[model samples]
Target: MEEREITIVKGKRSTPFSRGILAQTLSQAGAKPELAHRIASEVRAELLAEQRYTVEEEEVLARVRDKLIKKDALVVERLDKWRILRESTEPIVVLIGGATGVGTSTLAADVARRLNIQSVIGTDSIREVLRHAISPDLVPALHKSSYAIKPEDIRIPVKEENTTLYGFRIQASQVAVGVEAIVDRGLKEGTNLVIEGVHLVPEIILDRYRDHPNVCSLVVYLSDEAAHRSRFYIRALGTAMRRPAEEYIAHFGEIRQIHDYIVESARRMGVHTVENFSIENSSDAAVEIVANRVSGIAEKAARRPSSLLLDASARGG
Candidate 1:
């Protein structure tokens, strides 16, 4: 039997059928790799068997969705949500918050990969920028730790019952101003972003974005303090800078206090949360959470009329 290939038709233009695009759509819909590949291959065979030399782009998607629906109903739902994300007019913003050792950076990097969003910013980076902008002598709060902070140095109020906690909140507040500015730019430019770091506390950062349809926010924690400490050891080896295991352990009390504050605030804000025992599961959970929040805007985006050939160059033909 001679083999055949299908070209996807878009308006007046056409391109070869891309198995990669079908497989990616399936994977984004939460299908396991083996399953997504199997479905994509199956869909390709079915369409080509129809003997159509050229196929409409919508028809291509329909065939892929039909195969997915037969395999698992939930995947079809996920596909629709994934489609919404792809077709959205507004850029998606994912905010991940946690204390120093809780894997916020790891989770953000992974989620950014899954979502295909190019911009990922750490709040620490934001802080560093602010530091260069202002003098440490003037804004001492910007120069120091949330715990053991000298009130006179940073202008933190000593009268607060928990000055350590108050100081941490103040530090987060300073960094969040920069966070919001970056987020606003992404939103205005329609570029998806993933932002993670300690300073992204719920009250300071998550609360403002929670009500936005284009935003997905999560706070992660290490339920086991001992396990949390171990992450620094593994992290130090991966990066150029040595992890400050001793400094962090010495101030574990302050860090833990900030962790508790974030968890409590996330609870109140009704944002999604992850416990960082397993990075794989935590990353998966974040994708699902982001999908749920972005679903509302998907259909509206999908209904939009377009003349561009969005799938003409999807991976391989």
Candidate 2:
């Protein structure tokens, strides 16, 4: 017997139902990946047993919801919220800020994949572009690593701020120009983006967009010094030793200083901070924060009067 393929219909579109796609969606909405795959497989089996060849998207969602609620109600709520975020009119922007070796870039990529965001950029790339346009002599801090600013390159001498922080701020402030431009372009084009790097200092790049409904920012940090150092070794291996871990380890003090500064700034600014000891745990925490932020925006929009919503939409909010 030739088995029939299940077709899912949504509005004017019809596509083949895929357990892999459903599982990915479920995993993205806060469900454990293994459990998500199990649930997806079960859903497929149920449909096959019922001999249902055609189904509405809502029906599939309802079935998945029923199954998901039995195993975990919280994740089911997140799945609903994820759908709301998808239906939102504004583009999503996520800024991930952290010290070097704390895994901001890795977390940013993971979060982008979970949310299906197409644009992923790093602040380092922005800094590189700035280096080409600006002369090292003109802005010495811009040319050095955020954590490796030479004493002579320290242009700002704030009495209260330490030399390490002062140098980082000088470099980050210059990079902030590029970060802001990318953010503005994403907003204008309604393109979702994930921008992560040490240069995304909350006070520098986040202050302007922090209040925007579609913009969510968070900091990732490693609280334990030993674990933080280990990340550099792991990164070096991953990069085929092209970026020597010894170089980063040699400057661990400066890196940890910047780490503390960023973490403190996050706390002061009321931005969420994820202690990144484990990738899986940190990823869940990061995704939950983003989901909550998006869901809150969706709820507020839902409560507004249609006229106000329309007015806000027309104004490109």
RMSD for each model, in Å, please? 3.8, 5.6
Which sections of candidate 1 miss by over 4 Å? 1-4, 48-53, 145-163, 244-247, 301-317
Cα-lDDT of candidate 2: 0.83
1-317: candidate 1 lDDT, tens digit per residue: 77777777767766777777667656655777888788768867877777777788887778767777777887777666666676666678999999888999999987777666778899989999998998888777787865556557647457754776777787788898999999899888877899999888888889998898888899999879889888876777677655466777788888888888889989998877899898777876888888888777766664434312255233210
Candidate 1 local accuracy as lDDT? 0.78
Report the C-alpha lDDT of model 2 over 1-317, residue by residue, as the tens digit: 98899988766566787877778778877788899899888988899999988887788889889998889998888788777766666678999999999999889988887676778999999999999999998999899988888777866455543777898998999999999899889989978899999998878877778788788999999899999999999998887756699999999999999999999998888889999988878888888888888777665654322211112113222
Each model's total of backbone clashes: 0, 0
Winning model by lDDT = 2
Report the lDDT of model 2 for residue 224.
Answer: 93
Model 2 lowest lDDT segment of ten: 304-313
Could you tell me the TM-score of candidate 1?
0.83
TM-score of 2: 0.91
> Which stretches of model 2 miss by more than 4 angstroms?
155-161, 299-317
Candidates in order have lDDT scores of: 0.78, 0.83
